[model samples]
Target: MSTSTAPARRSTALPASPIRLTVGGILRSEWIKLRSLRSTVWAYAVVFALQVAIGLLVVSVTVSNTGETFRGGPGANIPELATLGATAGVIFGQLVVSVLGVLVISGEYSTGQIRSSFAAVPKRLPVLWAKLAVFGVTTFVVSLVSILIAFFVTYPILSNANITADLWDPNVFLKLVGAAGYLALSGMLALGIGAILRSTAGGIAAALGLLLVVPIVFGLIPADWSATISDWLPGNAGTAIYQSSRIFEWWQGLLIMLGWIAVAIAAAATLMRRRDA
Candidate 1:
């Protein structure tokens, strides 16, 4: 005798997203995630404190020294040097910022939180965009505030050395703002690298290499091509944006940096769409 077997029951599949996506919703989610992280809090606090402290120190030295004393020479006073000192900490603080950017995403991948994130928002690209928006805007605002404080506070001290600049001047204000922009874009670039590599170490190394190591290696390579290409790199081009002297024009530097950010992020989106969580 054959026994009839009842049909096995199956659970119904849910829609990819239960909640509707609005700009506000995505932004709120990203903001919550970003603020919840202790590392993000610490890194940003350190960045502001470290960069401002360096600016103060630089200007203090400016008040104390004669022409080119710090650079080890007797020469005419270089006005540009003062502004350079005002923003000098950025060159160093950027390293910390870049590491944080990499960790922002790679930490998720490592901890397997990314899968949960994808499970929540199956469309994926919105999450990436939201992350970029939240991080980029936050970084830009903080950086702008920090750099401006550095500029204003240091200006008076540097004035004692006859190194002064008016913020109204196109070159000066632009660079001051551009310094913040550079930091924001640099962070995004690191984020893109982090997305692509999906590893904290690899992402940080790639970002730092682009920001720090490539220039050094290229600088050491005894070839004009190396020098030319190096000058166009994100680090070098970006530096020109905020420097007292222009290497590439401000527009040129800005355009070059935007190009780098776009390419990296685009490549990341491509991989992210195809890859498994």
Candidate 2:
């Protein structure tokens, strides 16, 4: 009778509830996560290096070949000239931004940390929004700094070539700021796409295809259709804002880019809200 009673069964410990999401907290967390990565640092380094190198190369070529003759139309305009010089490396720098953008979300999924992230911020949309916010703000600031550095570095070279230009011209200011904004928006667009796909390779492929390959392929098509098709391409729209002569007006190009960003974010938000951690 003394041995008939069974020992008391132990209770299993329950898992703790997930953290509540806050916009500011999530943004801060994302900021730290982004900065902690090697890719972000490398992207900035690459952008800085590429800008300097391209600026120097352009200066050397222009100086050696131009024979001290200033280029036409607002090559005499100081602000436009400054903007052109400042963004000379943008084509290359943008690739770095694309990589960083893709890595921001795709990297989390690749590492299987998406679960932890979702656990900490169960409201998935806010997490995605926080990422978009972080990338947008950082890309803008970084682009601005990179362009400024490029401008200063390129200035002496342009002057050395006797290619006189003004950095204070109003239109030039518009182009300069516009270039940074375009790239920043493009970066966030990529970030949204990455979040939706949640795969680095897939994100990169889709982004590069949308940004680079599609444009090239479309350009090869007969002009009869190219005029209509080009306007819709992301790269065509994004870069149009930066050109001395734009296919679409700056605001038009901006709206096109905004459309892309909005569509991307909307799709990603839907997927995030519906998907499992």
Candidate 3:
């Protein structure tokens, strides 16, 4: 029986081309994902508005204080305080942005969307890099723009109080940039904590503990080591970037802050690799 089986029917569907994972592709995907979330939009808007509004409030307070000092005599040299009010909003902004950072990753984990992400990326680390890159760039740009807006708006108000600072001045410019950088690094640290914890509440709590509470607790302790450690806490180091009276130089403060960020990211990456999605 020389019966030949009929040729198998050909698939009308085209063979799927393998999707190549590139850094650019990953970054674009992350950007779209970040922008699509309504929470992301609200979070960023609130952060920018709150920061600028708080900066205005700080300038008003400073104006009130300066009037009394001017009445008494020539006010003390508070050149540092001249630009301080403009950037003061970053204090509140950092907290808000950090929370957003935590939500960025933890939200994914909580929703079980992370499995699809891991499946797509496969290697895993690319997703982390993409999130950090997209989030960090977004954070820095938003923070810098909002802070600068506050800075310019504060100029006329503060100038009337004889507290004007030239933006062209190196110190003024550096401090402004430093403030923005501080928020970026702070956000990155928060994201890393989120990745490690994979819970929004836990991530925020740990981040707040590290950035706010731990330093205060250490300060309350009387030991010399406690004082030294407190001086070098991430929050303190971040403040040093803008505060001239700090123990460490600005560059040193920046390095210290960067070190904290690096360590946090390393820990997060390690945990991310070992943990189950």
The C-alpha lDDT values of all candidates are 0.82, 0.79, 0.84
Question: Each prediction's Cα RMSD?
Answer: 4.9, 5.3, 4.2
List runs of model 3 lying over 4 Å from the truth: 1-18, 68-79
Q: How high is each candidate's TM-score?
A: 0.86, 0.86, 0.89
Which residue window of length 10 is worst by lDDT in model 2? 8-17
Q: Supply the global lDDT for candidate 2.
A: 0.79
> Evaluated with TM-score, which candidate comes out highest?
3
Regions more than 4 Å wrong, model 2:
1-21, 71-78, 162-166
lDDT of 3 by residue, 88-142 (tens): 8877888888888998899999999999999999889899999999999998888
Alpha carbon RMSD to native, model 1: 4.9
What would the per-residue lDDT of candidate 2 be over residues 198-266, giving only the tens digit for each residue?
999999888878888888887888896886787777777777787754477778888999999999989
Q: After superposition, how far is residue 235 of candidate 3 from its true place, in Å?
A: 1.1
Q: Candidates 1 and 2: which is better by TM-score? A: 2
The order by descending TM-score is 3, 2, 1
